[model samples]
Target: MLKFFSEEIDFKLPFPQKTSKWIKTISESEGYNIISLNYIFCTDDYLLEINKQYLDHDYYTDIITFDNSEEEGKIESDIYVSVDRVKENAETFGADFEVEMRRVLIHGLLHLMDYTDTSEELKLQMRAKEDECLLLF
Candidate 1:
């Protein structure tokens, strides 16, 4: 199941069904089944508080993913996305808002699939994967 929620932000996802189906397809392609996933959208301040409280990081990030997958080939997670950050990133990168938003969404899912970006090389790989996934959109 895929669910979307908002915290201190008045927002609605454009296409819930289509987005969920796409995410499911991505998970299946990575050899994992979606157990349950929640996408929580919030303002920068709200997400920053969450970062401080949960991760002890006092910084603004586009998304923070909490993995809850219990078994192999299963994916469960809470992906918190900061709408404010997404908008800013879109402008900074000269990309469309919807396109950047989709990238961030898939980026969180990639994290749950065991993709990391701690290094520049890995970040490049992650970006390539995100671009490929975006083509499916």
Candidate 2:
């Protein structure tokens, strides 16, 4: 089952229903049932610390996902998202805050599904999948 784990959140996001709907839809579409998901919404400072501690990076980002799955497909892990970054990106992208938040959520899910966005081509494909899943919601 898909679940959320808030660490240090400022405010609750709108469109939580839509987010859940898309996650379930995407999970099933990928031929996997979500055993559980831990979403930790926190400040940029918090996420930046996590990034440094876990990823060895010294920059701030929107989301970071940790995936744990066995060969038989049992999935578990924690996904950390920065609401501070999400708000800024929403403004920069000229999209609604909820929409941008969902985009971040989908980004993490895509990673869990073994999709990468490091290359231009891969990013394009990932964005396409994000768009397709967004439409489904």
Candidate 3:
């Protein structure tokens, strides 16, 4: 199952049903099944506190993912996104707000599929995968 939520923010995610279906399609294509997935939308400050309290990072970020799967091929997690950051990122990248937001959304799912962006090479690959997934939508 996939769900979208807003916490401490007045933003509503666009096309929740389509987004959830796309996420499920990506997960199944990557050989995993979704047990449960939640997307939490909030402001930059709200997400910054989560980053600090949980990740020990003081910087503001676009997304924070908490993976909760106890076994392989299963996904259960909470993904927090900053709508404030998404808007800025959209402008920074010259992309539409919804496009950038969906990228951030799927980026978290890609991580659960064993994709990492810790290095430059890995980041490139991750970006390619994200692009490919975006095209599928």
Q: Give the alpha-carbon lDDT of every model.
A: 0.94, 0.84, 0.95
* lDDT per residue (tens digit) for residues 81-119 in model 1: 999999999999999988899999999999999999999
Candidate 1 residues lying further than 4 Å off, grouped into runs, are none
Question: What overall lDDT, based on C-alpha atoms, would model 2 receive against the true structure?
Answer: 0.84
Q: Please give the lDDT score for candidate 1.
A: 0.94
- What are the per-residue Cα lDDT tens digits for candidate 3 across 41-132? 99999999999999999999999999999999999999999999999999998999999999999999999899999999999999999999
Error of 2 at 125 (Å): 0.7
Clashing pairs in 1: none
TM-score of 1: 0.98
When sorted by TM-score, best at the front, the candidate numbers are 3, 1, 2
Give lDDT: candidate 1, residue 93.
98
Order candidates by lDDT, high to low: 3, 1, 2
TM-scores of all predicted structures: 0.98, 0.92, 0.98
